[model samples]
Target: MNTQSLTKKWSKTICLAFLYSLSIFSNCYSKGNRIQSSDLKDSLISLLKKSGNDTLMIDSVYAHIRINRRRLGEEYKNTLLEYIDYTTKIQYSRGAMRMYDRLGLNERYDERYDSAVYYHLKSLELALELKDSFQMAYNYNNIGQAYRLQDINNLAIKNFHKALELQEANGNDKGASFTQNTLGAVYVVQKEYDQAMHYFRESQKIAVRRKDQRTQSYNLGAIGEVFLLRDQPDSAIVYFNTAKDIKQQMGDKKGLAVSKHLVGQAYFKKGNYVEAQKFLNEALVIHQKYNNERYIALCFDYLGKVKLKQNQFSEAGAYLLKAKEIASNIHSYENLISINNSLKEYYQEMDKWPMAMLAIQQNQQINDSLFSLKKTREMQALEIEYETEKQEQQIKLLSAENEIKEQRLKIGIAIITLLVLTIAFGIFIQKEKQKRFVLERDKVKQQLLRSQMNPHFLFNALGSIQSYMYQNDVKTAARYMGNFASLTRSILNNSAVEQVSLEEEISTLTNYLELEKMRLQSNFQYSIKVPEEMDIEFITVPPMLIQPFVENAIKHGIKNYTSGGKVELTFEETSDLIHVIIEDNGEGIDTTRGKMVSSHKSMATSIFKQRMKIIRDKFPNVPEPVIADLSDVNRKGTRIDLYLPILELTSTSNA
Candidate 1:
């Protein structure tokens, strides 16, 4: 497949892209409707099965392949790129090209239009070199698919025509038919309904002409898709049924699954929950059977809708979750957006405004990103064409003289690959940041949660006090009720501050400990190693973050200790952090299994750990509280070290 020329040409293109970062179209085509076939099915399957020796390579391949091929069949599409990477490194051009093509499809599925176009163009280059016109046409068709996904109809129409021409020229009837179908989609996107229907009819004719059941199924599905777009659910159902019959006859589970999904959607649109659920369930089984994850995700979403209508709240929630995972993993942006919106709706139904808002944000983010990408693709086109004007022209002249070298397309394809790779990298970083931000926000909520105490627990405490009062034990009941009132006051005070002043926080802890002391008189003693003149107020920490550890010390360690039951609290403030030390001379923790805690013995200790986890996740730089057994082997004692970064503030009042 001219490995040397391919590498050289690809490298040349990359070098130009790094400096320019633009995109160019080597050729254009008019839109056409074509039927789908199983031409690339074997190639997809073969690539999916390739597990390179390197696990990372396997992962990369799986990710890329999973991106594209997982929709067609139950095969792992994500792993395709990894295999292609290994194959390319090992100089397996055939496998590399297949992987490259798969990568483009992955990007296309991801709604990364520029990237998909770039990669597919490269695939086209390799296919043309290999003299595999069918493969080249496949690439063109995929590129058109990418554009179609982006709603770039002019370009989609153009690339679809290129594929159609190549397929027809090479007598690749199936390729031609499918390419024609895609063109119809572009027309639909452009709202040229007549042209769209014309292409669909043309695609159907080709499918029947070729007597290919697979193509016929896809043609029917394509018609259904258009009908669904027109909100003609009844008409869509008829076409979907036709597709289903053809797919079932051919034993093409994936095709049958999508058909059923369409039928489900049709029923869903007609407000027929029972029929929708039935068809959607059938679709789900078929999708899972064929490993058609994309369709499976779709079915999950529709199932959730059905469950929601049936008032099966838990079932609806479960299905939505599965839908989110599949849609996100598959890079089905539209599907992801839909799934997220559905999740938002579910949360809204539950009256969870915060969760609903969060889900809505996620859904909006996908839409925002797609919109941004569409804008970037436009800018990139101008940049690529302008920067590579000279080299591109030179390649054009050469291609005109000898059609044997479609180097321009190769170069554009290389550029597309680079663009997709870069965008993937950026998205990864953005996603991580988003995760961190969400974690931080939740930590803030956790820090504030105590203000809203559980009424039942409050009831129990008050009831205990009331029993004492009813028995004329006024002193004991008064002491217990006073402690409860103090705890409530601290909760209120803590709720008002985003972060706690070290001095005020320590005072709050002292109040809580004193109350516990009243409950278990003389069982424990505690002291804070705070300097009399130290400005503890200047050091801000997560509210109650340190208090939990101290509480754990009392409930587990000091309470059990027969002697030397003392809890020591110390604070050390430095330039960057405020370190808090909570050590008790009673009941050391079990060091086995990494400083294990018995939540059964002390729920306070367990809650402390959970709260700390939330803090660490929010403030990544804030270290986890370190636990150690500083006491002797048989001694009842444990020490915990917590390091909270100091808020960069000057005055205590400002905090």
Candidate 2:
């Protein structure tokens, strides 16, 4: 049972609206019971009508609904729906987005999970329209939580990852922390304790760093839950008490209630009947007051177990029936499972063999259904992994064939050049020239291989996939496999070429950066930009020229970043040269390479310099790359401007 509430954050605008609503709706807010739903609705409509298309005023009224959501209860949802309609009519996108999100969360609380997902998607669409990455991530997280509550593991994981990706890329540490906990909760449902703990600890670290007390409490409680699940009641009690203390200090009534319920469960597990009853009763009162059916059901179920342990058969039956009724009404399968088990035990105690058998069958059916769901998830994971491995093998075979063909072509060219030179010049002259040509070709080949597909990169990339699989993150492994394979294919395809179209080069670089992002766990953001008017398809540059610089930016520049790492590649052109500017908002060259000198540190750069020397021999006018530390006064990063001859392929050349 997920006792912890999903964390939510509002914009500064919402805080302002909260203040604004105090003056406008003070009576309705302070004396909620005295105000009827129809009166509240009319008052809200009057406020909206007065506000017209004024988004700020409309948002304030929306904020009022959110602030009084619990007090208004069912009426609050009516207010949100009306708010959404008003905002939609006026094309107030921001207000509409928030309304939909609030409505979705309300639906989730009411256990209308599919409706929750639908509203969150609606919110996401508006978030996208407004180009608000934070809001988009928020909606994605909300959708994931809804799915997770319904035990839809696959969709839940997909949405949670999407939220995490956006949050990390945007350096939204708070959002990332919240998403991490949600992901942990999913693994907990699946009984993947190790993975669950991994995520919970990650979230804890972020909460600690941010000094976020609420999040810290949530993490502590979650850790307690794991201990409870492992049958370590004493350890669970310690954590739950800590969480309860924190929430009490914060005066968080709702959070404190959940913490009390967890503590009660731990006490029951420890056979402390009096303390368990005291805490569970307290939790049940608060849950009833708040109309939180899920936690109420949980409280009742656990209370029944405690009473059953105390040999109060009649009382146990009463509590279990209450739990069953609520669990059934809310469609809480996990809670129903517990209630059914409790009912079975109670029936057996009463010597009702027929009733006991019915409860046993019901319990078994629920367990079987949950087991089948888990099995389906496992089978899907295996299928994805199998397909990924199959693709990897195919790519390897293709790469091997390409290598053999390349070697044979190189031999044929060498032979042809030897014959032509021997006929044109003296044998001695041919031998000297051939020796120099062979040495240069070998040097270029070695440098190209280092820059194109470094062994370390291949090893690390494959290792990342292996780690994901071992962690049972099959989706991530499959995604990594696809990117790795595409990057490998691009490297092999481009290796034989002297030059490639800028479009093709950019595509390869995108795959490389995407893989790096996944491998590094989205600690950084990257962008590739070209002028809208520029014709990249017709423009060619030396293969692997820009990649080394981009690699350096990632490996040495931003490798150690927790967040806010940025790499940008922009393409521009003059009459003679195409300029590829690679920039990173990371440690400058001096701090990165000079302070931490290593052989691998500048290997790509050194190889790229040598490669550039070779390219300059063919295009004599090409300029050497310019390296600059972007650390004048305000910012610190490395910028490298690589100049290349604008090589364009003619129609005949293409043929």
Candidate 3:
């Protein structure tokens, strides 16, 4: 049967679950039990009245809601909100945390990532204040999952690792398994299949040991996704079917629907159109019953593709349009992109060139919007990171201040013991204070230099945006603006930290180059190359360290070049240092002149030299940066080699 027919026939699963719960309550009430109520809210109110101010009873209610939160969904949101207020009135921290966490999960189910993260963070704060490590870990996992859903993989992975560490430390194997599974899912989105498989297998091992059927089913489905991505439909189907059977037996209707969808995808890949359509329709029916527009849209899209493969153009068009309508209604750009691509194919097959063009245009616009959305999410992630780092710094500062106060108090007491001893202690304290003052001055100086560099970077980027805007090129201007936001996000994010992964540094450089490329109207081309064997994520480097040199290379070496200007960046690592080479095939620096051509170049060079001097003095063993003039070598380019210390990031540092 088709998806539409199946959807029409399927009854509401949530209603059924509610009815089942009601039946249990009815049965208990008929036996003259105290648990007599017309609905869950009534029973909750009765329980509250009986419990009075008992914290344990309130906690139990919170626990009950958590256990059945999936079944409850938004059905008990108002009840939970009311309970949260009551918990707050009674100062029940644990109950409030659990309630907020459940509300976060419900928001997550509805794809309200911002609300989900907000609630999860609220729960995390309570967990921290209460010193509840398990709750902290659970909330971290939830927050990570919310970020993961929005494709903010970096922040998601960071939160997942945080949760994993706490879970493993607390010996909460089930929580650890869940976190590991989520980590695998994020890796799956990132297309790191081998890494994904590793986590999945590890999670599966724990789930199996604990006899966690739900987690086992999740693992199976995740493993199937890896196989599907690898184009091993035959293998994928086996795993998907196994997961589906488990979910069915476990009465996880939502999970079963997801598995059926995966099964349909495997069948589609295996060229079994009939089987694919059947499974997709079945999944679509469940999705419709649950009112899951995202999955319903996905089911329709896949069904449309299946029909397209079978030469059923009319059926394909119908399914694809239905998918598009639902996707558009929900503003699911990613799904709309897929649906449009399929519709483009359908239009082409039917020889409707204009319709095909329209579909392509729609996809392009959707892709642009997706890019903007991605940048917005990245900005949100960066803001969260910055806030977290700021809080940590403030905590450290407070601790240091407290320690200093305690030291002074001890010194005062020690002074009463002996005058001579006091003199010696006074001298020692003076030296320590002087040392701290010097350290603080250096830190402030470094921060000043960084602050200077950021404004310079921002001004250059703003100039590029302004240039496009002047030309009445709205499309290019918008694209450039999006890239600018992305670059600004990276800068603001890295500005909070002293060091960042080489991968991040490279990404920032790429964003800068993209903006420059657009601004220069493709007058210059650039390439950044790193060795394939390099583990960029494991290697930490100074944040925004290379951008100034690249900026110099672009503005001085290539800006006025007539044609074929190119800038190349290459990375090489020795045992002790990372060698970053920036080479530009343009006019080399003219040393014969009395001074540099631009004040910006002079300041950039001076600031870079000072930063390098600071690094050298701090780490005496590190090599200094080198600049070579290609003009002297009879080449029309400048080459700079930056020898940075190879700092390895520990697992803890990633958090």
Candidate 4:
């Protein structure tokens, strides 16, 4: 299926889950057990307190919250926030993970897939730290669902497989079945019906063996969808009816509604307009009761088609118009396209050529928008994958270095032990060897720092210049080339030195930022401020130490904005340190981070951190850089304060 169609289907799938949760709540509360509205807040607070320091209690509380979420509505969010805060305060990692997962689910319902993924990843990290395989599998499934909603099928499949592996390993058959069903759904969207059926059947077998009615109902509906996709309407109806029966037995009103809709669709395909309309209308009532706009629109479209087939032209037009209005209000392009296509048919049958033409035009516009959205998501996914891989490679490199260091340390200890026994005989020789080893290590460290100015930047800058040249923008290309050349020269000149004058560092940063601004079509503004009392020429700092943060602020933060992007660099001298602060008025770090698929530890940032480690080792009195999210301070950006020892350059050549 195309992205727009898949998106519409995904929305309904999410709504189904929402409704299922509601049903769970209803089942729990039906026997005069419902919490009164006035006691709801106090009840939740009591649950939180009772959950203190107890994982099982926390789990029970989370279950209650999940089931009651719909009834709690907007209040559910505040309750979750309070629960998260309490868990965090008590250092309850498991509780915090559960709450984060719930929060992510809430975000997903709001169609904020990026934010949902972020919270899921946070929960995943905690799961990893706690070595909780069940939570890990659950989080992986959640992340897959988020990616699936975005139409990022490859990533969604990857995460689903990860979840499936862990679930099976942990002997969580029910969890495994759930993940299998999710994987099948993704394959269905990809039009791999055969593969989808295989997964659906596997899930169904597991669900039947486990006596998991909920899972069985889900798998049955999925199997029906596969038949529907293959144009086997009779086969689809059989499965849909079975699913509907199971849902009714389980008192799953939401699942029953979904199955009814699918069954109605199959009936329509079989040309049983009267039967299709009956089921579709029934599903429509449930959807309207739940305020599920996507399903409401879907039912309207289906009902219109049934009416059209029955030759009820006026009724068909009315239903189609209703669907169109809902689709427009919700910005559901797929539904709008379907409604318009139905409108076109209605107009053509009525001999209204102008109305049919207008419908076709509107349909084409929606298709174009969907195509553009697909391209944008593809590009973002590619960028995220590339960055994640790069960071993984850097991490592997660091791990290898650490292993080598450990081996070296062991060897040194052994050598020292041996030498101690022969100290009188080899003291002078040992001292000379130790001195040489220190010198070589320091030399290697300096070389590593020099190599840290990644070649990727130079290549990308050159590529941009080439792009501008090819566009025949001679003046703009020339200016970009000049800045690139100047930045390149400054980097090469400073790479050999331990430090550079503050003035030289700032100048290089200025050149680099200017080129980036031009490359980004002047989307951002920047400033460098040095205290009047401080001598920029005399003070020296580690070469390229501050550039990474500045680069991050621009690329990840400001790049999201079309205009009003601002970055400020300020230098202040304390008695023992030079404070260099880089701040940006852009989307805060959290928003920028949500766009990333994985938390890629940046190579530049890693190198800077290593450099800081070296400084802390060599000059014990110097403080390290303090990176802060300005949002924590009630501001609107990121701030990095680098505290450097006020080292003066010996000469201009050294700088």
Using lDDT as the measure, the top candidate is: 2
All candidates' lDDT scores?
Answer: 0.63, 0.73, 0.72, 0.72
- Candidate 4, number of clashes: 0
- Error at 429, model 4, angstroms: 62
Best by TM-score: 4
Q: Lowest summed lDDT over 10 consecutive residues: which window, candidate 3?
A: 439-448
Which lDDT tens digits does candidate 4 get at residues 414-467? 999887766765765775763342210000011113344467776777677677
Instruction: Return the clash pairs for model 2, or none.
Output: none
Tens-digit lDDT string for candidate 1 (1-655): 5756654554444334322211111101112211122322343334335434434323323332322342334333434544665666765566667667777766765667677767776666666556565566677677666656655566667667866777666565556666777677677767787788887888888768756555567668878878888889999999999889977765556667778878989999989999999988987887787788888888899899888888898999999999999888889988888888788889988998999999888877878998898788777655644543453354332222134245446768999998997787986677576334221000101122352345644676666665665565655665565456445533532343456556556656666666555555457667777754344634566666676676668777777665457888888754346778888887576666565454443444566667667766655556666788866556557888888755433220100
lDDT of 3: 0.72
Stretch of 10 with least lDDT, candidate 1: 21-30
Q: Order of candidates by lDDT, top first?
A: 2, 3, 4, 1
Comparing 1 with 3 on lDDT, the higher-scoring candidate is 3
- As for candidate 4, its clashing pairs are none
**What TM-score, over all chains together, does every model reach?**
0.41, 0.43, 0.48, 0.49
After superposing candidate 1, which stretches have Cα over 4 Å from the reference? 1-156, 166-172, 186-194, 325-331, 384-392, 396-655
